[model samples]
Target: INFNDIKEWKAALCLLRSSPNLVELEMLARPEEDNLVRPGVSFWAESNQFDCPFDQLRVVRIVDVVGIRPELDFVKFLLANSPSLEKLTVKPVSNDGGLDLLKELVRYRRASIQAEVIYVDP
Candidate 1:
């Protein structure tokens, strides 16, 4: 899913909300042109009205993350909602802000005591 696209991102969230039995999930962000303007609204935070938890989801992998607020919010949402999640891996588009990204990710509350957030270089 392209996190930069509001419609696509919303659709992805809707899919997640409906897929309570999802086990492993992966999101790959295709690098977009730098000239494009980023969305100003924090959709994840605003649309966080999930009624069901991701009970069966265990693993998740997100690639090409750029440390955007929306991306971070989405990660935080998943961590706080997916009680069965064992591991969530995030691979940045580059090493820039990687440490800060990792720090921010760890600050979010986790629903699963065993859930581990891994940050990797691209």
Candidate 2:
């Protein structure tokens, strides 16, 4: 997935929605190309609601996150929806704002009591 591709982001969410038995999921941002453009809208919005919980999802890994709003929102959305999630590992692009990003990630409401949010350095 490209960090700024709105279509890819939305499609990923839709795929997750349909994958009820999913266990481990990984989203890694490809290294940016010179032609990449930022999306005009956030892929996951606060007003949107999911019809079902991710009951079988146990692990999630997101890499090279730039700490953008959409990415953070997606993380929050996943945290809120994945009732069976046990671990979520996030690796940022760099150390810049890493602390703040970790704080924001931890602040989100998680559906699983045992879910642990892990922050990894670049």
Candidate 3:
């Protein structure tokens, strides 16, 4: 689960999906040996599938999210799916549009859900 391979990441998601009672999900994506050959493609795709069957999930923390379309989509998906979600923490490595992402989430927060997003710029 510590590797950057796409297959491994997908497998992790499948495993996670099986757990319907998961209340918290944390994900960290690190490059393989500091190799920048790929520009966050693997993480992006994995993020898109972040919508697990965690009906009671309230916390989701993502660290080191690089600039990837799937990552953005994943965050949006979480905001839409996790009605009980209350907190979201994002730690970005660079200027990866983290603020804009949070704003979007805030804009879409439902009146019934008191969602708070804490963005830590790194």
Candidate maximizing TM-score = 1
Better of 1 and 2 by lDDT: 1
> How far is each candidate from the true structure, as Cα RMSD in Å?
2.0, 2.5, 4.7
Indicate whether candidate 2 or candidate 3 has the larger lDDT: 2
TM-scores of the models, in the order given: 0.89, 0.85, 0.64
Candidate 3 local distance difference test against the native: 0.63
Residues 19-117 of candidate 3 have per-residue lDDT tens digits of: 678789898855455443256465633464555544677888988876445455456656656767788777776776777765765665432266677
Give stretches of model 2 more than 4 Å off. 31-40
Model 1: per-residue Cα lDDT over 7-109, one tens digit each: 7777898898888789999998765554232567777776657575899999999998988777888898888888999999999999999999999999999
lDDT, candidate 1, equals 0.84
Mind giving the per-residue lDDT tens digits that candidate 2 earns over 4-105? 666676678778778889999999866455424455665465425657578999999999998877778788888888889999999998999999999999
Which residues of candidate 1, in runs, are more than 4 Å off? 34-40
Q: Comparing candidate 1 with candidate 2, which one achieves the higher TM-score?
A: 1
